[model samples]
Target: MRAIFAALLGLTTGMAMAEMKTEKVEYRDGDTVLEGYYAYDDAAYKGEKRPAILIVHDWNGLDGYEERRARELAALGYAAFAVDIYGKGVRPTNNAESGAQAGKYRADIDLFRSRLNAGLEALKARPGVDPARIGAIGYCFGGGGVLELLRSGAAVKAAVTFHGSLATPRPADAANIKAKILIQHASQDPSVPLTQLGDFIKEMGDAKVDYRMIMYNLAVHPFTVPGPQYNEVADKRSWAAMKEFFLENL
Candidate 1:
Protein backbone atom coordinates (compact mmCIF):
# COMPACT_ATOMS: atom_id res chain seq x y z
CA MET A 1 0.00 0.00 0.00
CA ARG A 2 1.40 3.35 -0.99
CA ALA A 3 1.27 5.97 1.72
CA ILE A 4 0.35 9.67 1.29
CA PHE A 5 3.65 10.44 -0.47
CA ALA A 6 3.13 9.07 -3.96
CA ALA A 7 2.66 12.58 -5.25
CA LEU A 8 6.21 13.47 -4.32
CA LEU A 9 7.73 11.35 -7.08
CA GLY A 10 8.58 14.32 -9.29
CA LEU A 11 10.23 16.46 -6.71
CA THR A 12 13.93 16.84 -7.37
CA THR A 13 16.63 18.58 -5.34
CA GLY A 14 17.34 20.88 -8.33
CA MET A 15 20.55 22.16 -9.90
CA ALA A 16 23.62 22.96 -7.92
CA MET A 17 24.03 26.68 -7.42
CA ALA A 18 27.39 26.94 -5.71
CA GLU A 19 30.42 24.91 -4.78
CA MET A 20 29.77 22.57 -1.86
CA LYS A 21 32.26 22.75 0.97
CA THR A 22 33.13 19.31 2.24
CA GLU A 23 35.53 17.97 4.84
CA LYS A 24 36.47 14.94 6.85
CA VAL A 25 35.01 15.20 10.34
CA GLU A 26 36.53 13.15 13.14
CA TYR A 27 34.27 12.18 16.01
CA ARG A 28 33.89 9.32 18.47
CA ASP A 29 31.64 6.69 19.97
CA GLY A 30 32.99 6.02 23.45
CA ASP A 31 36.66 5.13 22.93
CA THR A 32 36.28 4.40 19.21
CA VAL A 33 37.22 7.32 17.02
CA LEU A 34 35.30 7.67 13.71
CA GLU A 35 35.87 9.80 10.67
CA GLY A 36 32.82 11.04 8.71
CA TYR A 37 32.29 13.15 5.60
CA TYR A 38 30.50 16.48 6.07
CA ALA A 39 29.20 18.65 3.23
CA TYR A 40 27.22 21.87 3.03
CA ASP A 41 26.60 24.81 0.74
CA ASP A 42 28.51 27.47 2.61
CA ALA A 43 27.57 29.99 -0.05
CA ALA A 44 23.88 29.58 0.70
CA TYR A 45 23.92 29.41 4.47
CA LYS A 46 27.12 30.88 5.71
CA GLY A 47 26.88 31.32 9.49
CA GLU A 48 23.20 30.49 9.26
CA LYS A 49 21.60 27.48 10.91
CA ARG A 50 19.93 24.85 8.73
CA PRO A 51 18.38 21.45 9.08
CA ALA A 52 20.90 18.60 8.97
CA ILE A 53 20.74 15.09 7.58
CA LEU A 54 22.83 12.12 8.69
CA ILE A 55 23.72 9.51 6.07
CA VAL A 56 24.70 5.97 6.96
CA HIS A 57 26.76 3.89 4.54
CA ASP A 58 26.18 0.40 3.19
CA TRP A 59 27.77 -2.84 4.40
CA ASN A 60 31.06 -2.09 2.67
CA GLY A 61 31.48 0.86 5.03
CA LEU A 62 31.75 4.56 4.31
CA ASP A 63 33.03 5.22 0.78
CA GLY A 64 32.64 7.43 -2.29
CA TYR A 65 28.98 6.55 -2.85
CA GLU A 66 27.92 7.85 0.54
CA GLU A 67 30.05 10.98 0.20
CA ARG A 68 28.46 11.80 -3.16
CA ARG A 69 25.04 11.47 -1.59
CA ALA A 70 26.15 13.87 1.15
CA ARG A 71 27.09 16.41 -1.50
CA GLU A 72 23.71 15.96 -3.18
CA LEU A 73 21.95 16.64 0.09
CA ALA A 74 24.19 19.63 0.62
CA ALA A 75 23.09 20.98 -2.73
CA LEU A 76 19.52 20.56 -1.60
CA GLY A 77 20.16 23.12 1.13
CA TYR A 78 20.83 20.71 3.96
CA ALA A 79 23.94 20.26 6.02
CA ALA A 80 24.64 16.62 5.19
CA PHE A 81 26.98 14.33 7.08
CA ALA A 82 27.89 10.85 5.85
CA VAL A 83 28.56 8.88 9.02
CA ASP A 84 31.20 6.22 9.58
CA ILE A 85 30.02 3.13 11.43
CA TYR A 86 33.20 1.06 11.19
CA GLY A 87 35.47 3.64 12.84
CA LYS A 88 38.34 5.50 11.22
CA GLY A 89 40.25 3.57 8.51
CA VAL A 90 38.08 0.52 8.95
CA ARG A 91 36.72 0.35 5.41
CA PRO A 92 36.08 -3.14 4.12
CA THR A 93 37.33 -4.10 0.64
CA ASN A 94 34.97 -6.97 -0.17
CA ASN A 95 31.68 -8.63 0.73
CA ALA A 96 33.29 -11.03 3.17
CA GLU A 97 35.09 -8.27 4.99
CA SER A 98 32.07 -5.99 4.87
CA GLY A 99 29.76 -8.68 6.19
CA ALA A 100 32.18 -9.47 8.99
CA GLN A 101 32.41 -5.82 9.98
CA ALA A 102 28.65 -5.27 9.74
CA GLY A 103 27.96 -8.53 11.55
CA LYS A 104 29.63 -7.35 14.73
CA TYR A 105 27.14 -4.49 15.07
CA ARG A 106 24.17 -6.62 14.02
CA ALA A 107 24.88 -9.05 16.83
CA ASP A 108 25.24 -6.17 19.28
CA ILE A 109 22.30 -3.76 18.99
CA ASP A 110 23.63 -1.55 21.75
CA LEU A 111 26.83 -0.89 19.86
CA PHE A 112 24.92 -0.39 16.62
CA ARG A 113 22.61 2.20 18.09
CA SER A 114 25.43 3.89 19.94
CA ARG A 115 27.51 4.33 16.82
CA LEU A 116 24.49 5.78 15.01
CA ASN A 117 23.69 8.09 17.88
CA ALA A 118 27.28 9.15 17.99
CA GLY A 119 27.00 10.19 14.35
CA LEU A 120 23.82 12.09 15.12
CA GLU A 121 25.50 13.85 17.99
CA ALA A 122 28.39 14.78 15.73
CA LEU A 123 26.05 16.14 13.06
CA LYS A 124 24.12 18.09 15.67
CA ALA A 125 27.28 19.72 16.97
CA ARG A 126 28.41 20.90 13.56
CA PRO A 127 28.39 24.66 13.02
CA GLY A 128 25.21 26.07 11.39
CA VAL A 129 23.16 22.97 12.16
CA ASP A 130 19.78 23.21 13.86
CA PRO A 131 19.76 20.22 16.16
CA ALA A 132 15.99 20.24 16.48
CA ARG A 133 15.41 19.84 12.75
CA ILE A 134 17.36 16.69 12.06
CA GLY A 135 16.76 13.75 9.74
CA ALA A 136 18.62 10.59 8.72
CA ILE A 137 18.92 8.38 5.60
CA GLY A 138 20.71 5.13 5.11
CA TYR A 139 21.50 2.68 2.33
CA CYS A 140 21.49 -1.11 2.70
CA PHE A 141 23.12 -1.89 6.06
CA GLY A 142 23.27 1.78 6.80
CA GLY A 143 19.55 1.87 6.08
CA GLY A 144 19.04 -0.53 8.97
CA GLY A 145 21.26 1.73 11.06
CA VAL A 146 18.90 4.70 10.58
CA LEU A 147 15.95 2.56 11.60
CA GLU A 148 17.93 1.65 14.66
CA LEU A 149 18.14 5.38 15.27
CA LEU A 150 14.34 5.42 15.32
CA ARG A 151 14.15 2.33 17.52
CA SER A 152 16.63 3.95 19.91
CA GLY A 153 14.35 7.01 20.07
CA ALA A 154 16.92 9.42 18.79
CA ALA A 155 15.88 13.08 18.55
CA VAL A 156 15.27 13.12 14.82
CA LYS A 157 12.22 14.33 12.93
CA ALA A 158 12.57 12.02 9.94
CA ALA A 159 14.21 8.70 9.06
CA VAL A 160 14.50 6.93 5.66
CA THR A 161 15.85 3.54 4.68
CA PHE A 162 16.59 2.20 1.21
CA HIS A 163 16.58 -1.57 0.77
CA GLY A 164 17.49 -1.94 4.44
CA SER A 165 17.11 -4.85 6.76
CA LEU A 166 13.57 -4.96 8.14
CA ALA A 167 13.91 -7.33 11.04
CA THR A 168 15.12 -5.93 14.33
CA PRO A 169 15.97 -8.01 17.37
CA ARG A 170 14.04 -5.59 19.54
CA PRO A 171 10.76 -5.03 17.72
CA ALA A 172 9.27 -3.69 20.96
CA ASP A 173 11.60 -0.73 20.68
CA ALA A 174 9.60 0.51 17.69
CA ALA A 175 7.35 2.23 20.21
CA ASN A 176 10.26 4.47 21.06
CA ILE A 177 10.33 5.89 17.56
CA LYS A 178 9.73 9.63 17.35
CA ALA A 179 10.19 10.26 13.64
CA LYS A 180 8.19 9.71 10.50
CA ILE A 181 9.71 6.89 8.42
CA LEU A 182 10.05 6.12 4.72
CA ILE A 183 11.25 2.72 3.57
CA GLN A 184 12.30 2.03 -0.04
CA HIS A 185 12.42 -1.67 -0.63
CA ALA A 186 12.68 -4.21 -3.44
CA SER A 187 9.61 -6.36 -3.92
CA GLN A 188 11.65 -9.27 -5.22
CA ASP A 189 14.60 -8.93 -2.91
CA PRO A 190 15.91 -12.35 -2.00
CA SER A 191 17.69 -11.04 1.06
CA VAL A 192 14.44 -9.56 2.41
CA PRO A 193 11.36 -11.65 1.80
CA LEU A 194 7.70 -10.70 1.86
CA THR A 195 7.23 -12.34 5.25
CA GLN A 196 9.82 -10.01 6.69
CA LEU A 197 8.02 -7.05 5.18
CA GLY A 198 4.75 -8.23 6.68
CA ASP A 199 6.32 -8.52 10.10
CA PHE A 200 7.86 -5.08 9.82
CA ILE A 201 4.54 -3.54 8.81
CA LYS A 202 2.87 -5.18 11.76
CA GLU A 203 5.62 -3.92 14.08
CA MET A 204 5.13 -0.37 12.92
CA GLY A 205 1.36 -0.69 13.20
CA ASP A 206 1.59 -2.15 16.67
CA ALA A 207 3.85 0.70 17.73
CA LYS A 208 1.43 3.28 16.30
CA VAL A 209 4.18 5.05 14.38
CA ASP A 210 3.76 6.96 11.14
CA TYR A 211 5.56 5.05 8.39
CA ARG A 212 5.56 4.42 4.63
CA MET A 213 7.07 1.56 2.70
CA ILE A 214 7.50 1.48 -1.10
CA MET A 215 8.29 -1.72 -2.90
CA TYR A 216 9.86 -1.88 -6.34
CA ASN A 217 8.89 -5.06 -8.12
CA LEU A 218 11.69 -7.29 -9.48
CA ALA A 219 14.38 -5.24 -7.80
CA VAL A 220 16.75 -7.16 -5.62
CA HIS A 221 18.81 -6.34 -2.54
CA PRO A 222 20.78 -3.10 -2.64
CA PHE A 223 18.82 -2.00 -5.69
CA THR A 224 19.69 1.65 -5.20
CA VAL A 225 23.41 1.11 -5.51
CA PRO A 226 24.93 1.55 -8.96
CA GLY A 227 25.90 -2.05 -9.55
CA PRO A 228 24.47 -5.40 -10.56
CA GLN A 229 21.45 -4.91 -8.32
CA TYR A 230 20.88 -1.33 -9.34
CA ASN A 231 17.33 -0.39 -10.32
CA GLU A 232 17.37 3.06 -11.86
CA VAL A 233 13.62 3.55 -11.61
CA ALA A 234 13.56 2.58 -7.98
CA ASP A 235 16.59 4.65 -7.12
CA LYS A 236 15.28 7.84 -8.70
CA ARG A 237 11.77 7.45 -7.36
CA SER A 238 12.95 6.61 -3.85
CA TRP A 239 15.31 9.57 -3.77
CA ALA A 240 12.59 11.94 -4.95
CA ALA A 241 10.31 10.52 -2.32
CA MET A 242 12.93 11.14 0.36
CA LYS A 243 13.47 14.73 -0.72
CA GLU A 244 9.78 15.47 -0.42
CA PHE A 245 9.56 13.71 2.90
CA PHE A 246 12.40 15.79 4.32
CA LEU A 247 11.05 18.99 2.83
CA GLU A 248 7.81 18.42 4.68
CA ASN A 249 9.05 16.93 7.94
CA LEU A 250 12.34 18.72 8.54
Candidate 2:
Protein backbone atom coordinates (compact mmCIF):
# COMPACT_ATOMS: atom_id res chain seq x y z
CA MET A 1 0.00 0.00 0.00
CA ARG A 2 2.80 2.42 0.87
CA ALA A 3 4.53 1.62 -2.39
CA ILE A 4 1.32 2.20 -4.28
CA PHE A 5 0.81 5.57 -2.68
CA ALA A 6 4.39 6.55 -3.42
CA ALA A 7 3.87 5.64 -7.06
CA LEU A 8 0.74 7.76 -7.32
CA LEU A 9 2.34 10.84 -5.80
CA GLY A 10 5.44 10.31 -7.91
CA LEU A 11 3.71 11.75 -10.95
CA THR A 12 3.01 15.16 -9.46
CA THR A 13 4.82 18.49 -9.63
CA GLY A 14 8.54 19.38 -9.58
CA MET A 15 10.67 21.01 -6.89
CA ALA A 16 10.86 24.71 -5.97
CA MET A 17 13.68 26.87 -4.65
CA ALA A 18 15.00 29.92 -2.78
CA GLU A 19 18.60 30.83 -1.93
CA MET A 20 19.73 30.37 1.69
CA LYS A 21 22.42 31.52 4.09
CA THR A 22 23.64 29.11 6.77
CA GLU A 23 25.13 29.75 10.17
CA LYS A 24 25.84 27.86 13.37
CA VAL A 25 24.01 28.57 16.61
CA GLU A 26 24.50 27.09 20.03
CA TYR A 27 22.08 26.23 22.84
CA ARG A 28 22.18 24.39 26.13
CA ASP A 29 20.21 21.24 26.89
CA GLY A 30 20.65 20.94 30.62
CA ASP A 31 24.32 19.95 31.13
CA THR A 32 24.85 19.18 27.48
CA VAL A 33 25.66 21.87 24.92
CA LEU A 34 24.45 21.54 21.34
CA GLU A 35 24.78 23.30 18.00
CA GLY A 36 22.61 23.60 14.89
CA TYR A 37 22.57 25.28 11.53
CA TYR A 38 20.35 28.33 11.11
CA ALA A 39 19.25 28.89 7.51
CA TYR A 40 17.43 31.95 6.32
CA ASP A 41 16.78 33.85 3.14
CA ASP A 42 19.69 35.95 1.94
CA ALA A 43 17.21 38.76 1.59
CA ALA A 44 16.76 38.88 5.37
CA TYR A 45 18.69 41.65 7.04
CA LYS A 46 19.22 42.65 10.65
CA GLY A 47 16.25 43.52 12.92
CA GLU A 48 13.70 41.57 10.89
CA LYS A 49 11.82 39.23 13.18
CA ARG A 50 10.08 36.91 10.77
CA PRO A 51 7.99 33.84 11.47
CA ALA A 52 10.21 30.80 12.04
CA ILE A 53 10.15 27.05 11.46
CA LEU A 54 12.25 24.44 13.23
CA ILE A 55 13.46 21.61 11.02
CA VAL A 56 14.40 18.32 12.67
CA HIS A 57 16.55 15.72 10.94
CA ASP A 58 16.20 11.97 10.63
CA TRP A 59 17.91 9.34 12.81
CA ASN A 60 21.11 10.28 11.00
CA GLY A 61 20.88 13.55 12.87
CA LEU A 62 21.92 16.89 11.34
CA ASP A 63 22.96 16.64 7.69
CA GLY A 64 22.92 18.55 4.43
CA TYR A 65 19.45 17.34 3.46
CA GLU A 66 17.88 18.85 6.56
CA GLU A 67 19.87 22.04 6.01
CA ARG A 68 18.47 22.24 2.49
CA ARG A 69 14.95 22.02 3.84
CA ALA A 70 15.69 24.83 6.24
CA ARG A 71 16.97 26.89 3.32
CA GLU A 72 13.79 26.11 1.44
CA LEU A 73 11.72 27.35 4.35
CA ALA A 74 13.87 30.45 4.61
CA ALA A 75 13.31 31.05 0.94
CA LEU A 76 9.61 31.02 1.75
CA GLY A 77 10.27 33.96 4.12
CA TYR A 78 10.41 31.95 7.35
CA ALA A 79 13.45 31.84 9.58
CA ALA A 80 14.38 28.17 9.70
CA PHE A 81 16.58 26.39 12.18
CA ALA A 82 17.95 22.97 11.28
CA VAL A 83 18.48 21.53 14.72
CA ASP A 84 21.02 18.94 15.81
CA ILE A 85 19.66 16.07 17.88
CA TYR A 86 22.93 14.20 18.42
CA GLY A 87 25.12 16.89 19.92
CA LYS A 88 27.32 19.29 17.93
CA GLY A 89 28.57 18.21 14.50
CA VAL A 90 27.89 14.55 15.24
CA ARG A 91 26.17 13.05 12.21
CA PRO A 92 26.07 9.31 11.62
CA THR A 93 26.98 8.22 8.11
CA ASN A 94 25.73 4.64 8.28
CA ASN A 95 22.37 3.15 9.17
CA ALA A 96 23.85 1.13 12.04
CA GLU A 97 25.27 4.21 13.71
CA SER A 98 22.10 6.13 13.06
CA GLY A 99 20.00 3.43 14.68
CA ALA A 100 22.32 3.31 17.67
CA GLN A 101 22.10 7.06 18.22
CA ALA A 102 18.36 7.00 17.78
CA GLY A 103 18.09 4.12 20.24
CA LYS A 104 19.98 6.00 22.94
CA TYR A 105 17.68 9.01 22.55
CA ARG A 106 14.51 6.89 22.50
CA ALA A 107 15.56 4.96 25.58
CA ASP A 108 14.87 8.10 27.56
CA ILE A 109 11.91 9.95 26.15
CA ASP A 110 12.20 12.80 28.65
CA LEU A 111 15.77 13.52 27.67
CA PHE A 112 14.81 13.38 24.05
CA ARG A 113 11.98 15.84 24.61
CA SER A 114 14.28 18.13 26.60
CA ARG A 115 16.82 18.26 23.77
CA LEU A 116 14.11 19.18 21.30
CA ASN A 117 12.62 21.77 23.58
CA ALA A 118 16.03 23.31 24.07
CA GLY A 119 16.37 23.67 20.33
CA LEU A 120 13.00 25.37 20.24
CA GLU A 121 14.13 27.77 22.90
CA ALA A 122 17.25 28.53 20.94
CA LEU A 123 15.22 29.38 17.85
CA LYS A 124 12.95 31.65 19.85
CA ALA A 125 15.98 33.43 21.23
CA ARG A 126 17.13 34.43 17.76
CA PRO A 127 16.94 38.17 17.09
CA GLY A 128 14.49 37.99 14.21
CA VAL A 129 12.21 35.30 15.57
CA ASP A 130 8.71 36.02 16.88
CA PRO A 131 8.59 33.84 19.95
CA ALA A 132 4.80 33.64 19.82
CA ARG A 133 4.53 32.36 16.26
CA ILE A 134 6.75 29.33 15.73
CA GLY A 135 6.24 26.04 13.92
CA ALA A 136 8.15 22.77 13.47
CA ILE A 137 8.69 20.21 10.74
CA GLY A 138 10.71 16.99 10.70
CA TYR A 139 11.70 14.17 8.44
CA CYS A 140 11.91 10.43 9.20
CA PHE A 141 12.93 10.12 12.86
CA GLY A 142 12.66 13.85 13.28
CA GLY A 143 9.07 13.64 12.10
CA GLY A 144 8.31 11.41 15.06
CA GLY A 145 10.14 13.88 17.29
CA VAL A 146 7.98 16.76 16.08
CA LEU A 147 4.88 14.70 16.84
CA GLU A 148 6.23 13.96 20.30
CA LEU A 149 6.62 17.70 20.84
CA LEU A 150 3.01 18.20 19.84
CA ARG A 151 2.06 15.37 22.18
CA SER A 152 4.01 16.97 25.03
CA GLY A 153 1.73 20.01 24.82
CA ALA A 154 4.31 22.42 23.43
CA ALA A 155 2.88 25.80 22.51
CA VAL A 156 3.47 26.04 18.78
CA LYS A 157 1.28 27.11 15.91
CA ALA A 158 1.90 24.22 13.53
CA ALA A 159 3.71 20.86 13.09
CA VAL A 160 4.46 18.79 10.00
CA THR A 161 5.82 15.25 9.54
CA PHE A 162 7.23 13.67 6.42
CA HIS A 163 7.32 9.85 6.24
CA GLY A 164 7.50 9.56 10.01
CA SER A 165 6.18 6.86 12.29
CA LEU A 166 2.67 7.59 13.52
CA ALA A 167 2.38 5.38 16.61
CA THR A 168 3.75 6.22 20.02
CA PRO A 169 3.93 4.10 23.17
CA ARG A 170 2.19 6.71 25.28
CA PRO A 171 -0.88 8.53 24.13
CA ALA A 172 -1.02 12.33 24.31
CA ASP A 173 -3.70 14.41 26.01
CA ALA A 174 -5.98 15.91 23.40
CA ALA A 175 -6.57 19.03 25.43
CA ASN A 176 -2.86 19.75 25.68
CA ILE A 177 -2.08 19.96 21.98
CA LYS A 178 -1.92 23.59 20.77
CA ALA A 179 -0.48 23.13 17.28
CA LYS A 180 -2.26 22.12 14.12
CA ILE A 181 -0.69 18.98 12.58
CA LEU A 182 -0.09 17.83 9.03
CA ILE A 183 1.29 14.32 8.43
CA GLN A 184 2.54 13.10 5.06
CA HIS A 185 2.81 9.34 4.82
CA ALA A 186 3.86 6.83 2.23
CA SER A 187 0.85 4.57 1.72
CA GLN A 188 2.83 1.37 1.33
CA ASP A 189 5.46 2.05 3.97
CA PRO A 190 6.44 -1.23 5.56
CA SER A 191 7.61 0.46 8.74
CA VAL A 192 4.11 1.74 9.48
CA PRO A 193 1.63 -0.92 8.48
CA LEU A 194 -2.05 -0.49 7.68
CA THR A 195 -3.15 -1.51 11.16
CA GLN A 196 -0.92 1.05 12.82
CA LEU A 197 -2.12 3.78 10.50
CA GLY A 198 -5.74 2.98 11.22
CA ASP A 199 -5.12 2.92 14.96
CA PHE A 200 -3.29 6.25 14.83
CA ILE A 201 -6.09 7.86 12.84
CA LYS A 202 -8.67 6.48 15.24
CA GLU A 203 -6.78 7.80 18.24
CA MET A 204 -6.49 11.25 16.70
CA GLY A 205 -10.17 11.22 15.80
CA ASP A 206 -11.15 10.15 19.32
CA ALA A 207 -9.02 12.92 20.75
CA LYS A 208 -10.72 15.38 18.42
CA VAL A 209 -7.36 16.48 17.15
CA ASP A 210 -7.25 19.00 14.32
CA TYR A 211 -5.01 17.29 11.79
CA ARG A 212 -4.65 16.08 8.23
CA MET A 213 -2.92 12.90 7.06
CA ILE A 214 -1.91 12.94 3.41
CA MET A 215 -1.10 9.56 1.95
CA TYR A 216 0.92 9.79 -1.23
CA ASN A 217 0.15 6.71 -3.28
CA LEU A 218 3.54 6.57 -5.01
CA ALA A 219 6.03 7.83 -2.46
CA VAL A 220 8.09 5.70 -0.12
CA HIS A 221 10.34 6.27 2.88
CA PRO A 222 12.71 9.26 2.54
CA PHE A 223 10.59 10.61 -0.27
CA THR A 224 11.48 14.19 0.48
CA VAL A 225 15.22 13.76 0.69
CA PRO A 226 17.30 14.94 -2.29
CA GLY A 227 19.34 11.76 -2.71
CA PRO A 228 18.54 8.55 -4.53
CA GLN A 229 15.53 7.91 -2.31
CA TYR A 230 13.95 11.18 -3.36
CA ASN A 231 10.96 11.38 -5.67
CA GLU A 232 10.95 14.84 -7.23
CA VAL A 233 7.20 14.91 -7.76
CA ALA A 234 6.25 13.72 -4.27
CA ASP A 235 8.71 16.08 -2.61
CA LYS A 236 7.33 19.07 -4.48
CA ARG A 237 3.71 18.26 -3.72
CA SER A 238 4.31 17.48 -0.07
CA TRP A 239 6.25 20.72 0.38
CA ALA A 240 3.50 22.66 -1.35
CA ALA A 241 0.98 21.12 1.00
CA MET A 242 3.17 22.00 3.97
CA LYS A 243 3.70 25.58 2.81
CA GLU A 244 -0.05 26.05 2.41
CA PHE A 245 -0.77 24.42 5.73
CA PHE A 246 1.76 26.54 7.63
CA LEU A 247 0.62 29.71 5.89
CA GLU A 248 -2.93 29.06 7.01
CA ASN A 249 -2.22 27.76 10.51
CA LEU A 250 0.79 29.84 11.55
Best by lDDT: 1
Give the alpha carbon lDDT tens digit for every residue of 94-188 in model 2. Answer: 99999999888777777778888889989998877887889999988899888877777877899999999777766655556788999999876
TM-scores for every predicted model: 0.92, 0.87
Positional deviation of residue 150's Cα in model 1 after best superposition, in angstroms: 0.8
Tens digits of per-residue lDDT for model 1, 150-170: 999899999899999888999
Best by TM-score: 1
Local distance difference test, per candidate?
0.91, 0.84
Task: Output the TM-score of candidate 2.
Answer: 0.87
After superposition, the stretches of candidate 2 with alpha carbons farther than 4 Å from their true spots are 1-20, 42-48
